[model samples]
Target: MSDSTQLARQVVQALLDAGVREAVLAPGSRNAPLSFALLAADRAGALRLHTRIDERSAGFLALGLARTSGRPVAVSCTSGTAVANLAPAALEAHHEHLPWIAVTADRPLRLRGTSANQTTEQVGLLPRAEVLDLAAGDEVDVPVGALLAARGPVHLNVQFDEPLTPVDDWVPRPTTARPPAPASTPEPKVLARGPRTVVVAGDGAGPAARLLAEQAGWPLLAEPSSGARAGSHAVPAYRVLLGTELAAEVERVVVAGHPTLSRPVARLLGREDVEVVDLAPDDRWQPRPFPVVDSAPVWRVGDGAPDLEWLDRWREAGRSLAARVRALLRAEGDVTPHEVAGVVAGAVGARDLLFVGPSNPVRDLDLMMTPPPVDRSARVVANRGLAGIDGVVSSAIGAALAHGAEGRTIALMGDVTFLHDQGGLVLGPHEPRPNLTLVVVNDDGGSIFSLLEQGGADHAHAFERLFGTPHGVDLAALCAATRTPHWRVESVAELEHALSQPAGGIEVVEVRVRRDNRREIDERVRNLRP
Candidate 1:
């Protein structure tokens, strides 16, 4: 057997042994050996194979698969630009702490500085990820094991010579070695119950934040993607509340995960009067502008709970604010972004998974999504790491595939975001398609910028051309071209009905709305009261 083939087989075997169930491949000549090995592994029923022509899409697809499955996933591509394309997804994996194995094929070391056509510095290409350089004869077990242990994005730049083909079929052996036990986290810190505190659960804060809030009788200001945003303590109108007088009364804030969504929360953290206690999993503090009074692995309540009156005050104001916002939403004659987000959130079941796109859709969800019943909460995932709108469609597909047949997966993205990675829709007929329903809010342009300072009267002259980069691509035609089902929903009822139907294979449901009223709607929301 060829050395390249042997090395590829060994690496694939190591990955499978380390419990990698899914892998994505971007075709190239130098990576042929690895591709063959991956195919063999797929045929052996050891792993599933996903193929994408675009390396960027492939990387994000692997990211989504790993994010949902809670298992490591591998993404392999050829040398130079192909490997470089995986950087955005790799960076997201690094910040989100999702386990991803980046396997890049490289020319042998001798070709490093010798004018190789498809060669560049591929070893440390992903600065945030742990890098492992492998030659034909290098031991594969250690690096693979280390990647499994790190539980984040890891790079394996495997150098292959000419003859990149497998001579014999290789079957992977199941790993007998048990995964190492997770390190014991410190007990939740017992906080004094005297202060008027609220739990701020951000990004991957999970359910621990909700439990802490419920136990302490404090309100939970959880971001839409926080996973802890279902319980009664979860304040639905948190952003609005943060802008109100209620936020000014806050004496202390308990933070979990990284809060990067709203300026109000950032301002609250920056206040010298407010005592901040952070419960970040890692040593790095999230609220950098202000000093954290206490930083710990987890936080527990003391024997006493916070004043019930204080909790009641926040809850009452939040309930009132939410009612007003809903009233305003009801006044809108046609379907709006807020209504679309609400319908999407309401349609998702406990067993379902929703991948929210980065831009406006996620923010709309944050503002308007009715908190689901605690027992029936759907899992919400977002690319909040870098929060870029790239590869959202592919990510959603990957999440759906990882979720399998039992659960449905929905991706909520704006028209601009959907257009950004439309390449994700280009799946071959032979590839395994997921049960994904993509709900796109078609605003015709970048409406998100309209709500920002860029859309102010001062910048109105240059707004449409510069910030609002409108594309006139027909989404239905795009879906038709890809052979995916497409539905255009005009009303909330139509959207709800579309979401209620049995979802199988890939499909697109476009919700069209106007970009002109976005600024007005945002203003009305901010000005709303009980």
Candidate 2:
């Protein structure tokens, strides 16, 4: 048996020992040993292996799989540019603090400067990742404890010698997962309850954010994907309310997780008069970006009574605008993006998974959806780490597959985002497909830019060509290419009816909307204040 085969098997065993039950593989030459080993593990029921032709998609698939399963997942690709393709996903994982493992096949040390094919210093490919560079013939003494303990990205670059494939037949080994090392959690601090405060729950902010707000009688400004959004304190149209007069009365903010959705929230946080108290624990990277006056591992309400009127005023103001928002939404009868987001978001049931994309879709979702029922679970997640519209389709699929069988998944993404990784729908007939309903808000172009400053009259002339970049592709035909089911709806009634149908497998619900008048609608929404 070649040493390369032995090393690959050891690496596979290490992954299994580390409790990595899912892996994505992009076929390549040098990584053949790893691929065969992964396949063997899959056959042995040690792990589930997913294969993708595109390394980029494979990385995100692993990312979403790990995210939902709450366990480390690995994506292996060949060396050189193939390794580079996983960089974007790695960067996203680093920022999001997800443990994404990248196993890249590399050429041995002897081929470093010898013009070897597909060999270009794979060690430093993922800058933010903790790299374990393994050469051609090395012993299997890896720091499994530290690797498992790392809550961020990890890169494992393996160098294979002349024998890329296994010379001997490999049998998968069943391994038991090591018990995790225990770590101490900080005692939650107490926040004095005098000042009027609101909890700002951003992406990945857990249920603690909601419990704190509910107990203290404070409004919760939770982003759509924030796990805390299900509680009674959550304010749905928070971005709109952020512009109201009541928002100016905020004396303090108890922020958790990372908030990057609206300019109004950013401006509110920037206010020097308002005290910012962050309860967010240190992530894999830097701490909260705002100028926080107080920081804690977690926080509980102090003895003094909270300002009840402050929260009531905010809720009243938010409720007052709902009628106006509905009026405006009804004024222009055609299916609007907000309506699309609302319909899709409202359709989610208890324990259902909702995965949104970056840009307007999530923002629209934020505006139109209300909080989930307090007792039920409706898990919402996004790639809010970098918030780029990359590989979202694949991520949603990965998430759906990992989601429990009790509930289904509904994914909301824009046309551009849906198109970005639409190839995710190209699954083999034998692949284990999940029951996921993917809804695409088809505004035809980058409608998000129109709501930004670049949409002003001064830049109107260049906006369509530069920012919009409209693509006239036939989406139904595109879905047809993969033999996936698709539905295109142009009205609210049509959308409701389409959503009412039972979703069995991976399907696309393309809600057609217009890009024009987006700025006008958004301005009206922002103007809806108490």
Candidate 3:
């Protein structure tokens, strides 16, 4: 009926046109007009709208929903502090390669930063965010359509020119035309099909996993965070398919997503007959041999026929693997590796956890932590999607905030992974979270690199200088400044004690593993394997 109403309707329509099927909104006065418009759209079945009270939690909730749906979900909030609260999740989406969209109702161009009730400069809050400012407009917006063209996350800041209202002659239209979002340019695919090709999904796996498997007709294996659910796609319960009776059958394998959720399984895939392919997010293409693939699209179309029998077999295999690992850990009686794993696994709650994947830490956890004798309880997590040690800290923090403190959150990372994003630990502190833990397996060097053929090479100096960056960072000092509690443990007993203690606020457990000693233990474990 009015210009403001028409503009509001167009803005909402623009979001829907940009693949924003899901919207999470927080109620407020300044944003009432935008809120009403979105609610009307939701009621009309034009979009799925979720309402939450806390803007910070609401922002993360939108992130989690986007993660589940494999689409760029939007979070709508009122002006001033509400917009400020979204910084945490936005920061996470940026670092973890998640395409998230946010619509914030702002104060008019004049009242900004003055003594206004709910008004602040929300425009440049997230500089890294791909911001699209839509000042109340009529006619179609093409740039909004282009914003959805890319696969990553974005922010759509809606600046209403005061007195918000509904659009004139509004009629709801159903969305029918669904076009194939372009796949990230594929990197040269490596690892030819062998006798048995196993596709492994580590932590934070998206829907693209199923598509890739269907295209290649390869058997899929997924870790917890790889986002491969138990009922759909590959039997995500295939953690048992590695390092046991079924190990020989897997002649070749592709490692998609993260491998940290099931470290034992990742190690099994790293064996002589296996070739690991790292798929980062569904966007950005970069494929390397056992390196990260950033360009693979993660949309969930053509995943697979529900292979119940296939999943059953993996479930059986997982049962056996769990038993074996438990027995071995019991026999060892809190060995160094086992203790380290206990500290991590024990500290984490049933919520979400992010595991940082490097050669040494991931491999050690694979050989240690005994999977529970019963059904899987705590979901083991890792960034096996394109498993690079970079951004591990940021990813875990994002996952924690994504799940929020109501659920427990923990991150198991190496010293190197922690060092990579040490600065990220204190990012956007205004959006505080209580349920977060950081576990660093400090061995002082790139021990995983040492396990490779490069260890014995004469270029020890060069390799150490390049890969094994051992900058001695004081964990205690960093924790003190950041308000994250820091604990140092040299023995298994101390580690157990630290793990048993409850985590208040954020906790960083620094477990010191001697590099030489870790190498010796790993060598012995390899000798013990068949």
Candidate 2 residue-wise lDDT, 399-506, digit = tens: 998995868898999999988898788777767788888898887899999988898889999998999989988999999999889998889888888888846898
lDDT of each: 0.88, 0.86, 0.60
13-109: candidate 3 lDDT, tens digit per residue = 7677667777777778767777878878887878767666667667665665555445667788888888887876776566556667877887666
Runs of candidate 2 with Cα error greater than 4 angstroms are 284-287
For residue 185, model 3's alpha carbon misses the true position, in angstroms, by 25
lDDT per residue for candidate 1 within 1-530, as digits (tens), equals 88899889888888887778899999999999999999999998889999999999999999999999889899999999999999999988987888899999999999998888989989889858898888887454436568668667899989999799876778777665347578997776778887889999888888988998998899999988898999788888889988888888999999887787888898998899999987665533343556788888777788964678888888788888988988898898978898899889888889988899987899889888777778899999998888999889999999999999777889999999899899999999899998899999999999989989999999999999999888888999999998889999899999999999945789999999988889999999988775
Q: Over 4 Å off in model 3, which ranges?
A: 1-97, 101-151, 154-224, 227-339, 346-354, 357-359, 369-375, 427-429, 461-463
The TM-score values for the models, in the order shown, are 0.97, 0.97, 0.54
Q: What pairs collide in candidate 1?
A: none
Measured on C-alpha atoms, candidate 3 has an lDDT of 0.60
Candidate 1 segments exceeding 4 Å error:
138-142, 281-289
Better of 2 and 3 by TM-score: 2
